[model samples]
Structure formats: C-alpha cells, structure tokens
Target: MELITYWISILPELGNGVINTLIMTFLAVSMSAVLAVILAMGRMYGPRIISTLCKWYIEFFRGTPLLAQLFIIYYGLPSWGLNFSSFTSAVLAFGLNSGAYVAEYLRGAVQSIDKGQMTAGLAMGMTKFTAIRKIILPQALRFVIPPWSNDVIYTLKYTSIAFLVGAQELMSKAKIIASFNFRFIDTFVFVAIIYLILVLLLTLFFNWLERKLKIPGFEIKN
Candidate 1:
C-alpha cells in the first residue's frame, strides 16, 4: 500500500523523465532515418569507393557495442576538445548506432524492389541518381516501414543507456527516485511496465502504418 502510494506521489517527477526519454528517442530516430537514407543510397548506387566506405561504416557500427560507442562520444571525445552535453552525446551515439541498422533495413528494401523500376526511370532520361531518389527510394521507404518500426522501438528502449552518461532520462530519473526511498524493485518494475506500454503502443501504430501504406495489388515477398 505504501509502495503504491509512493508511486502515485512520484508520478510527476517520472513524467518529466518520460518526456526527456521521448525527446532523445525522437531526435535519435530522426537522425538515424536521415543517415540511413544517405548510407543506403551510397551502398546501393554510389561509385566503388563510396560503396566500400559505406559498407565499412555499417559493419563497424553493427559489429561493435552501443555502450562503448556512447562512452566514446560522451567521455572520450572530451579529451579531444570535442565535448558535448550528456543529452547531445546520448542522442549522437544512439543515432549513429541505429543509423547502421536502419541503413541495412533500407538496403534490403531497395533490393527487394524490381530492377526494372530503375531501368524504366533511366529510359525516361532520368539520371541514375535522380531515378533512385524519385523512383526507387519512395517505394523502398514504404516497404521498409515494418522493420524500421522495430528499430524505433529499439531506440526507445535504448534511451535507458543514456542514464550512464548522466542524462536525466527515464532510467536516470528512476534511479534518483529509488535512491531516495531505496525502493529499487518497485521503481524498476514500474519503469519496465512503462516501457512495455510504450512498446505496445508503437507496435500498434506501426501495424496500422504498414497496412495503410501497403499496396493493394502488389506485395513484396519477405
């Protein structure tokens, strides 16, 4: 009963944390989407050198630990005189890390598109780059929605990592609250419930989006 009351009383503080978490997730997801488009374009259509560089970049981020990336951005970069606020560092780290995964999702979508689409665009006098941007990428973006939604959920959960960087996001706020009352179990359990709720809501939204964007007469094979 006391625990329940305590939870209710602290809702305002936790709400602030939730806002911060949402901010980080929103910014990171936006950055990741932009980077994903650029990286996917480079990998699929750029010259050999650009393609190779994009490949290397995707592999590096995918191969490494996100936590390590966050540390380097938040901590290590300070010594090099390129410092950022904790919130900024967290956003950058999550964005860069998520960008690699989102790029692969986009690349797979692009490949699933018919090769004939590009040819049709070029035969109409469109440059290869223009054709890709106008003809191929729009279709690819629609196709990529399902997998990209999963990435958004992942980013939302991953914001918890920002706590280690002293970003006062959800997990960080939870920790501060728990420390005062020494109710770690209650605090974390509540936080987990909050996360689960957010994930469910996102899943529902994406499902609706996938259906809405789906072509009536065409389907892409998974």
Candidate 2:
C-alpha cells in the first residue's frame, strides 16, 4: 500500500517525464528523416561531391558513440559561441546521430529496386528527380518502414541519455524519485516495465504495418 501510494503521488511527475521522452523521440525521429533521405539519396544517386560529403557525414556519426556526440553538442559547442537548450541539444544530437543509421537502411532499400525502373521512368518522359520522387521513393518507403520502425525504437531508448545533460526525461525522473525512496530496484523495475510496454506496442504497430504494406513477392526481411 505504501508503494501504491508512492507511485500514485509521483504519477504526475512520471507522466511528464514520459511526455518529454515522447516529444524528444518524435522530434528526433522527424528531423532524422530529412537527413536520412538526403544522405541516402546523395550517396546513392548524387554527384561525386555530394556523395562524398554524405559518406563522410555518415561515417563520422556512425563511427562515434552517440553520448560522445551529445556531449560535444551540449558541452563542446558553448566554447564556440553557440548555445542550445538542453532539450534542443538532445533533439539535434540524437536526430543527427540517428540519421546516420537511418541513411544506411534507406540506402539499402533504394538500392534493392531494379535500376531498370529508373530507366523506364526516364524513357517515359520523367526527369530523374521526378522519376525518383514518383517511382523509386514510394517503393523504397515500403521497404524502409520495418527497419525505420526499429530505428524509432532505438531513438526512444536513446532519449534516456537526455537526462545526463539535465533534460528531465523518464530515466532522470526515475532517478530522482528513487533517490528519495532509496528504492532503486523498484524504481528501475517500474521504468523498465514502462519501456517494455512502449516497445511492445511499437513492435505490434510495425508488424501490422509490414503486413499491410508488404508487396506480394517483394517482402522485405528487415
């Protein structure tokens, strides 16, 4: 009963933490998408200059630890006369970091489609941009969805790092509450359960999406 009362009392704080986590995840994922499309397409289809730049960007992020990058954004940038709010830093760092991984997934999807499709579209009077926008992207989106869903889940967990830089996300909230109660195990279990529930729901949604969007023989294995 004491535990129940404790949880009930902290419900509002935990709820807000959940909201911040969700907001961070959504914002990061949304921004990451722009990077994903740009980087994926640039590397796959653009000129050597664009492709090289994209490749380097992808390597820099993908090769480094996300926390290290977050530290640079939140801590290192202040020395250069740049400043961002903790939340903003978390969003941008996480988004850019997630984008690197997302780009590779999207690139594979884009590459899987036959090159003949682009040729056919061009022959039918479509410009390269129009052909990709119309023919390549639609099919590529279907293929990327499953893996992108995984990326979303990954982003959700990564938001826990936001707390390290003073953004009060779910993990931060849990830490605060646990510190008071000295009930670390209980607090961790509660947070873990919440995370599990969130992931389970996301997995179900992605499974349903895959079933609905999958082409007959073109079923993606992501």
Cα lDDT computed for each candidate against the true fold:
0.93, 0.92
Task: Report the CA-based lDDT of candidate 1 relative to the real structure.
Answer: 0.93
Q: What is the lDDT of residue 4 in candidate 2?
A: 70
Give lDDT tens digits, candidate 2, residues 16-55.
8999999999999999999899999999889999999999
Clashes of 1: 0
Clashes, model 2: 0
What are the C-alpha RMSDs, in order, of all predicted structures? Answer: 1.1, 1.4
Which structure among the candidates has the greatest lDDT? 1
Q: TM-score of each candidate?
A: 0.96, 0.95
Candidate 1: residue 22 Cα off by (Å): 0.3
Question: lDDT of candidate 2?
Answer: 0.92
Clashing pairs in 1: none
Local accuracy of candidate 1 as per-residue lDDT tens digits, 10-48: 889999999999999999999999999999989988899
RMSD to native, candidate 2? 1.4
Error of 1 at 8 (Å): 0.7
